[model samples]
Target: MKELHKTSFWESLMIQKRVIGALLMREIITRYGRNNIGFLWLFVEPLLMTLLMVLMWKFFRADQVSDLNIVAFAVTGYPMMMMWRNASGRAIGSISANISLLYHRNVRVLDTIFARMLLEIAGATIAQIVLMGVLIAIRWIEMPADVFYMLLAWLLMAVFAVGLGLVICAVSVKFEFFGKLWGTLSFVMMPISGTFFFVHSLPQQVQEYALKIPMVHGTEMFRAGYFGSSAVTYENPWYLILCNLVLLLFGLAMVSKFSKGVEPQ
Candidate 1:
């Protein structure tokens, strides 16, 4: 019985792996197409946006935010923001977009959401690495003080993104208006996301309030890794982890509940 159970577990794992892989391929093909740039667009799109932001900040706000390298700040902050937005945004309508795929016996709703989340995370991570490498080589930015901590914070942010994405996916499917609502809400979230500014730069009261947000903590943690003691980060990693865990559990429950009622189209 133990051997059989082990075999069954591995088989299920392999099946899920294959399903996610196939969905990723399909997602890339559908979104990017097989034309000139193709998959390269994944990295290029975010790179260009980061470059634009870097230029804007360097030229327009160089002295506005003192003691910070605008180019490095833009590269780190913007890509993280894009990761959160892109992952959750794509997940919002993932079910509806891939409704036909759900008709297949092996294709689950979570698979669709995971595929999009993974794709966005992968793309953003690649863009971040490449952009940071170039910036370091050009002497625009120094190497991070602690690469592991930086990656840890980024991973935490990605987890938070996935949890939020799953919840948004479940809710958007159940309520038609949620999709539109989230679009507006995401914009509202930007200023508070610790993307353009550091938490310590704000007033004490404002910093207290901003720490309530999980994304703020994640961003602070990442910045801490890069800026070392020079960066002021008001972060509670444990708090962020707890919140993400709760969100993930709720998201899974919601998805499982709604998925049962999803009819084939």
Candidate 2:
């Protein structure tokens, strides 16, 4: 009996893996289409946005928040912000968008959310790497001080984005108005997200309040890794992890409960 149960568990896991893979492929095709530049848009979209921001800052000769490279600063910060926005934005109303897929016995609400999240995260990560490489090759920015820590910070930021995405997805499904409200509210989050500036650049009290936002901690930590000792970060990795965990758990519970209540269209 025990052996049979274990075998069934592994088989179930494999099925889910395949299902998610299929869903990912389908999502890409649906969003990007079959043209030559179709899939390229995944990375290109974010890359162009980052490039525009970098050029804008460069043209303006924006005063450095720190002594960090302005190009590198924009490269790191904008893509990370896009990861959060893209993931959550795509996740919102994902179920309704892919409602037909729900007819399949193997498909689940979480699977749709995961597929979208994976696509957004993958695109953002690829854009960041390509942008950084180009900048370095052109001598526009120095190599990151700690490659491992830089990657770790990026990973943590991705996790937070995914958690927040899941929550947004579930909530939007429950309340239709949430989708529009969140779209407008996300813009408000940008200035405070530690994207355009560092937390330490703010006044002491404001810095304390800013660190409470998980994305700020992730951004500051990412800069700290990239710029080495010169970077000033008020990050608590543990706190960010805890917040992700709570959001993830709550999101999963909500999705599981509310998904069953969704009426087929």
Candidate 3:
């Protein structure tokens, strides 16, 4: 029993590490290929999107929310939300899209899911740091007052995203329509998830409803760290952590069941 346990432990640690490293390298190269700016699009794309959103919002809602700079406000929540959205959306189709690779017994479904999720998370994190650096350089945003909270928030958000992605990956494997539903739901989540604005700014009833989604709670914690006291009200940090743990367990259970029961058509 001890020997089996030790073998399992080593395999889980060493094999998963090897799998993640190889997959991550593949993702980075495939995303950029042999180019001068290889892998830079990971940051460039989000920064440009943030810039566009800021310009559009400024043109329309400039006077309505002048006190909170829209760019700074966006910098707080948008990238985090996009990280979840992009990771979950792609994860949902990961199995189907890579069915060929999974047919090889060595490439487990969980490994693929982890690889995809990590790729998206790493790309998004890099983009966020670069954008924040630019904002700081231009004096549009200040250094985080609580860098620890910012780090913690990002860690929680990654956990939250991976949990959500696991659920989506399992469902999409069994029901292809799940991919479409994921896309639709991501749009629905955008306005209500507090990705572009602070939660307290919303009406009380709206805030209560938004808090029902764990992602909103995750984003609130992230924004709190980035904007500090200026972020308005946030659910307790422990509450967010507890919710992420529950979601992760649920996602793992779902994926395990799916792997056991479902085979590709």
How many backbone clashes does every candidate have? 0, 0, 0
Better of 2 and 3 by lDDT: 2
Best by lDDT: 1
lDDT of 1: 0.88
Judged by TM-score, which candidate is best? 1
What's the lDDT for residue 202 in model 1? 94
Q: Report the Cα lDDT for candidate 2.
A: 0.87
Sorted by lDDT, highest first, which candidate order results?
Answer: 1, 2, 3
lDDT of 1 by residue, 1-265 (tens): 9999999999999999999999999999999999999998888888888888888887897857587777777777888988988899889878777989987889998898999999999999998999899889999899998999999999999999999999998888888899889988998898889898888889887888888988888888888889888777788899989989998999999999998988768
Q: After aligning candidate 1 to the native by TM-score, how far in Å is the CA of 247 from where it should be?
A: 1.0
**Per-residue C-alpha lDDT of model 2 across residues 183-241, encoded as one tens digit per residue:** 88899999889998888788987887888888998888888888888777778889888
- How much does candidate 2 score in TM-score? 0.96
* lDDT by candidate, in order shown: 0.88, 0.87, 0.77
Candidate 1, superposed: residue stretches over 4 Å from native = none
| TM-score of every model versus the real structure | 0.97, 0.96, 0.87
lDDT of 3 by residue, 13-129 (tens): 887788678766776787678688877776677778766765676567763755666666777788888888888887876665555666555667777788889888887888888
